[model samples]
Target: MGEELKVIVFSLAHEQYGVEVEKVRTIERMQPLTRVPKTPAFVKGVINLRGVVVPVIDLRGRFGLPEADYTDNSRIIIVAVKDMEVGMIVDMANDVVDVDSDNIEQPPEIVGGIKAKYLRGLAKLQDDRLLVLLNLEEVLNKSEIVQLEQFGE
Candidate 1:
């Protein structure tokens, strides 16, 4: 049997994306955010989780997609990177599915304008479903990570 990667699948625009389940801290509903100035557009702002301030980012804007209004389906995917916890705004958090290791192929030069480095691989699932696996660390460069960590201080 091939190895499997448990991933949390989410929707952005019409495309589906996935991140390793082990990296996820928790999934939360839409919450009020305190906007921070001079940060990247994707860096929507920060949210207080149990009194712990966490930086929230918009995955759509981070991928250069046109922003969309938050609706009932929107969700915040909280994940940990290094020593920091960060939240990502997604159109919809879909499922926790297992993608076979053998079925994952390296992403092409560019997948929907997102850099290939930010992708772990592409999983072609049943019913012609395509899941783009995201590399959480690469999603935010070192500098960006540092900036996010500082937001909580």
Candidate 2:
């Protein structure tokens, strides 16, 4: 069998989540955010990263969870999807975890009313904590994102 997939895990609303490490470009501190009007509530705003203006999405609100106050551990996880570099804000970034394919199970039919389509899988850790593996593309690919672009145009 091939080697296991490595993921960078993070926390949001006290729940553990993860995304493929390969998809993650970097983790940066939360910077000044510029709000975009008429966009989805989950889209916190945009920030310029080294001259690249990237949209920042708040994972807590995106998942329909209560908004969380940013703390010292808050971070923006920069992930590359296709040709776009997006930033996802989370309560705190945990660590990179390696899990065999067998250890990752398909997301259940229901996750607190969240569609399984947004999830890549579910990783069970040795410590008995569950990590909801996120499907980066699906989670961030919303009509509102496109609408925001039109508004700016």
Best by TM-score: 1
**Best candidate (score: lDDT):** 1
- The alpha-carbon deviation from the true structure for residue 87 of candidate 2, after best TM-score superposition, in angstroms, is 0.7
Q: Write the per-residue lDDT of candidate 2 for residues 1-153, one digit (tens) a residue.
A: 436989899988777889999999899998899998877889888888887888888988888888878989999999887667779999999999887777788999767556788898898877888889999878877565575444333
- TM, every model: 0.96, 0.90
Where does candidate 2 have its weakest 10-residue lDDT segment? 144-153
lDDT of 1 by residue, 60-91 (tens): 99888889999999999999998789999999
lDDT of 1: 0.92
Clashing pairs for predicted structure model 2, backbone only: none
Q: Which stretches of candidate 2 lie over 4 Å from their true place?
A: 148-153
Worst 10 residues of 1 by lDDT: 140-149
